[model samples]
Target: MCLCCFLDDGPGSLREGCRRREPLWIVFEVSGTINLVSQLSVSSYKTIDGRGQRIKVAGKGLRLKECEHVIVCNLEFEGGRGHDIDGIQIKPNSRHIWIDRCSLRDYDDGLIDITRQSTDITVSRCYFAQHDKTMLIGADASHVGDRCIRVTIHHCFFNGTRQRHPRLRFGKVHLYNNYTRNWGIYAICASVEAQIYSQCNIYEAGQKKKTFEFYTEKAADREGSSSGFIRSEGDVLLKGAQPCLLQGVGENCVFRPSEYYPTWTLESPLDSLKDILQICTGWQAVPRPAEMLIVA
Candidate 1:
């Protein structure tokens, strides 16, 4: 079912309409702005598809307060100069959620934040610019334990005007092919048992201070192939500059140069080793054991 409404009419009207149906889809087609003085909470199985009409939610976009199966797509959230006004926040115990093709900017806390028992989430093809905190996965992790898991972030662009760090805590996160440019301490930081598998990700540092830093008190037991990690000239590693650990069949996978042209194949050890050397000067290349190269 499809329900379209104007924000000027009032959120109470939208709330009443949502109560009538259990798990319905709402579409907003108005090409204007709406001021939400308070937070907007969505019920379970509710999908808000904006259809590129620019439904500017003024307050916090959708606070999923213990609600599950929520989908927010193609929407733009404007926080309107407020602190802690996150674009979309999935509260504790929220599960099986998807946020795609959304543009979130200009807030104190973050563009999209998931915390407190949220799991199995996918955030793809979103844009975040000019915010204090761009994206945070499981900020309030102390209370939530290791509840946030299986988070997949792909094809997203994050450009921040202020110096802020994008952090992930105590969860298994997969960050793939995302473009991050300008601002902040670390493009990504994981603490505790949070294992991050990142690949083909580009980190373009703005002409400010540093580029990236990742730290964990206990050594991070991570596994992945990260080729073509491009950083600005001013990028520096602060602590524990160790090459990302790879396991299983990935142990034998040699790093490859980022081939921009179609017909060029990267040469074996030299080109691949140069790519790794460009990123981390301390990285060492050695012969892989025969058993480690065997793939089942």
Candidate 2:
């Protein structure tokens, strides 16, 4: 399945090609920026590959609804602004997903959202900038099903983005080896009994940026005692930055993310993360397909 130069199969458009094809690898043959008026609804067992060339999808983005075994990489999503629209929308039924080396920003909604039972997802090596409400792991406050949502965000660059770098509601989130430069409002928000483990990250908060650690959303309708639990270790906050941990979140929960699942363990410290993550984040080093050659 190749989406080359906005070519569509029929009346449905590029979005339909994604749904009609199964267990397929979609590659972009066209280079440079292309405009999109509609979103591409991704299906299961699909990989959107944007290697070897710069493929930019603007005006709208992609959505993963009840999808599995999906991989999206090396694509740029820009100028996405509308209600219920985002760079990528992952619903509860999405699972076994990997989104890597993508540039997502300036969306009307969140850059990425995993909610309503979405689990087993990994977002890595992506660059996020010029957006507010960047990410939302769990969409709403009342969805008890969110307790099943689990995510891993590593080696990504959160640059000058506003809050929800992501705000979690339930389940365990492991965020490590990430660089956040100049945040807005609060970075790393955990609301409504969420368990967050943050480690080995670099936070360079700007003059107006507030709070690098976990913060609980204090709303009128929420219980005063229901707060998220966050265990932070080996993080570096630069000048004009202050770290704060709010009270009353994940009151009775545990902070050992590795305990929930053995593989979630993070061995890298902050010192080494700064060196490695410097070249990993953004679209700096996109993984080429196996057949592509590398020059020294």
Candidate 3:
């Protein structure tokens, strides 16, 4: 069923719905916290739409493994624990995914991680806070399968996270209109053949000043695999946000988002970004749809 009316049957009902082969739109009938014992696996062609109600998933998180065409929206994730745990983990050939308006915090490993050949994903309007290792785009240099990964991250608020505002490896990431502030370590990292295009982002720093860093790793290709490429344009740096630790590397990149996807929503940097990202990003309170408003 589309509506998860009760959890007396346990969270398996929702997990089972995600495992179904056919397309499904999953929504909740009740608003509360789901304390998962393990990572919930999401199958293909599913939309976990958490709009109109407040829903929080804690303890364990989600795993999107080898699936495609999934849309996750307006969910709050926190308190994910244990080894290799992430608020959302997409990996091993999954594609065509979108994660929007989610608030993720205090995960053991990372808030979101896309790796192992996964591609064609977009993360937008999400808020990340109170965590280290915020996001990781690729697995490692040995997993050459990550070469085809293409991701777009936009309108996200990275608030006081420790590091990896997304560390990239062997992928192309289009980052735009994101507000990142008060980072503990470095803000963004480029490692091992990653192509990152950062545009119109606002970076406000506290203590740690480096905005970008390059990690050296030997790529599986065995070519000139010293570091990745990052190109930043129209980015605003404020309050001691250093322009990239690796200078001369931010420019001279071939990958551009416009060449792949034609259009995307973008806002001007600085005060506008600070205002909008703080107010509009993350899980929103929306009215329930008429179909779910049935009187019982």
Candidate 4:
């Protein structure tokens, strides 16, 4: 089943009439801005596909609060502003999600936040630019339930951002074949027992900022196990950037490989990431004809 959010020449409201929110496809028609008045709460078993047209969202962005089997593809989330607003927020036990081929800007607070026990999420082939604090996985240290947050961030382009390409916490994450350039503070942050496995990622940092940093409150304690650790396996590190390991979990920590994530579509990198992000990231536009067509 499918429902169409047809629009006129100007802006349209996503909540004006689109109500049956579950087990259907919401196909957007026409190209304009959908000025979101509030957080667009997505329902389960639904796919909001924004393909073939140029659509923009203002104010608040999409919020997947405890929803399952959702796919948001080929949309542009730009110029979102508010208190702690994100381009996409996957929260509170949501699972089996895929976010692909979307262009995201600063959007004020951040780009995407996957937190609160959300597992089996894939944020792949997306373009993130003109933003600071790009992505955040796992809610916080206090939310120990975030240990179940398993995420895969692959083949995404993070360019000209300040930090938090993702700052993680207490989750098993797989990051592979991504591109990052001109970061402000840090690229990947580890906090609160989070384990990050970075492979074949290109990390380029500026003069002031560091490439990667791991934060643990127990650094002073130096006890049995550290809270956060970043295991760098054959990644491209440039410009005085170094992967800071936690106290106890140094370069010899247990290898938590990419096997933790379930099966999904992935492109394996054969050494060079020269063109992996060219056609994968951002809004994938369909080409138009050179000449016009006349109808009788």
Candidate 5:
């Protein structure tokens, strides 16, 4: 139903609606910003759909902890402050999530973090700008449980984000048809047994031209030779973006998206692809009902 609460803290609030046990398709009737006092913890089987109305969530962020079957679409997340606070965090056994067409920026920590055995996620058509530590897949080297993480990030725009276009620890990540530009340190990182498949993506560098960075960390499970692996196919690097030196990491075999899903939209990394991402990604305006009907 609709979140008619413009204040965002009432009984008919977005927080209360998300706390409900039953599945809900939560939409917004009001067009305004919600300054969350704390982290908005979402329940299982919920869809926070923000179409037709421009809804911005700031101050705090969303925490998807130990939940499943969530879809966050067409929302704007900005100015998340505090220690270890992320714009959107999916962790600790959360699965089957799709974060699509959202704009996230200026977070104290990561914009989006999927870690701690979270899997079956797809982040598509989202825009990330003016943030640092952008998106992180796995938590760290010590968290070996993150080896089960499998994420697909496609058709997203990473605009001038400072690092971690998604730095992972140990996981299988699929990066396809995405655009990342003007990163401060590095564009994509694979650390400690992570497998990344970069297919038909564009990486444009501005001042600092380092595109790929790899690090070897000791995982809790592994004994020796702990390093990440990435296989790039048909990716475009521009503006003096340096190519990755460590091309062959793990036996020249990285997991491909075609092995799992049957089909997906694919495009060549052309210069015009930058225009498509800037124009089409992030929140969009659509038609919706004028009246608010909150589900009980």
Candidate 6:
């Protein structure tokens, strides 16, 4: 069964109505903001679809306290000038969740945080701009045991104004085809037992800035790995034609694009990367990253 409705035009109380329905599909038609202080608790089979740019969810936005199979798409979450106004907060034991095609900005804790035993999640095609902390996959490795939550972040853009924690703790994370610019420290940091597969991602620092860095302590360093897969066509490193740092280990996993992705006008290096990885890994066809930008 499928359900579809709008939240903006609904009269009376929106939260009361939403609470009553367990499985629902809500669409936001108006262009106002809604503040959620405690939590906008959703059921397992609920989807909140913001119809185009008509709705803006203000305040702390949706907090999936302990829900599963919930999907949120195509909305803007404004923190509204305060701290801890996180866009989406996923508590522990939440699974099978998807957050796609949304813009979250100006928050204190983080744009999206998965804390306390959360697993099997996907965050794709989202834009996180002007955030206090960009994306926190795990709160603390100590609290979540040795196994950190597993997440896939594909085709997202994070414009960090300051040093933000992209992925904290340790987990199996696939960060593919994302763009990050103007960060104070590491673009993506994996502290403990993290198997990070990064491919076709672009990282740009401000003037006279560095690209990427990784850190780990001796006790927390339990086989944390970082690998660079392939480069995009417009990668600045490819055009510069310098010696690339193809691979490195923890505490030394800093990759500069200009070194590996040097531009060669004669041959298309970007196109060749696809075929190269296939022959080595025996993977059939490479997948293109998601495109999240929508201009109307």
Maximum-TM-score candidate: 5
When 1 and 3 are scored with lDDT, the better candidate is 3
lDDT of 3 by residue, 76-190 (tens): 9999989999999998899999999999999999999999999999999999999999999997899988989999999999999999988999899999999999999888999
Model 3: pairs clashing at backbone N, Cα or C within 3 Å: none
Using lDDT, rank the candidates from best to worst.
Answer: 5, 3, 2, 4, 6, 1
Point out where model 2 deviates above 4 Å: 7-14, 212-225, 244-252, 260-279, 284-287, 290-296
Task: Give all TM-scores, in the order shown.
Answer: 0.68, 0.85, 0.93, 0.83, 0.95, 0.69
Q: In what order do the candidates fall by TM-score, top score first?
A: 5, 3, 2, 4, 6, 1
How does model 5 score by TM-score?
Answer: 0.95
Candidate 3 or 6, higher lDDT? 3
Ranked by lDDT, the better of candidates 4 and 6 is 4
Residues 55-81 of candidate 2: C-alpha lDDT, one tens digit per residue: 777777788988899998888888986
Least accurate 10 contiguous residues by lDDT in model 3: 3-12
Give the runs in model 3 whose Cα sits over 4 Å from its true position.
5-12, 245-252, 289-296
User: Number of the top candidate by lDDT?
Assistant: 5
Residue range 247-266, candidate 6, lDDT tens digits: 33443342332332364122
**Candidate 2 residue 121 C-alpha distance from true site, Å:** 0.6
CA RMSD per model (angstroms): 14.0, 4.3, 2.5, 5.5, 2.1, 10.1
Please, what are the lDDT tens digits per residue for candidate 1 over residues 27-55?
54345565666666777888766663555
* Model 2 residue 267 distance off true place after TM-score fit, in angstroms: 6.8
Q: Which ten residues in a row have the lowest lDDT in candidate 6?
A: 280-289
Task: After superposing candidate 1 on the true structure, give the runs of residues whose Cα lies further than 4 Å from its correct spot.
Answer: 1-4, 8-14, 17-21, 80-83, 161-165, 208-212, 215-296
Off by over 4 Å in 6: 1-14, 80-83, 146-148, 217-296
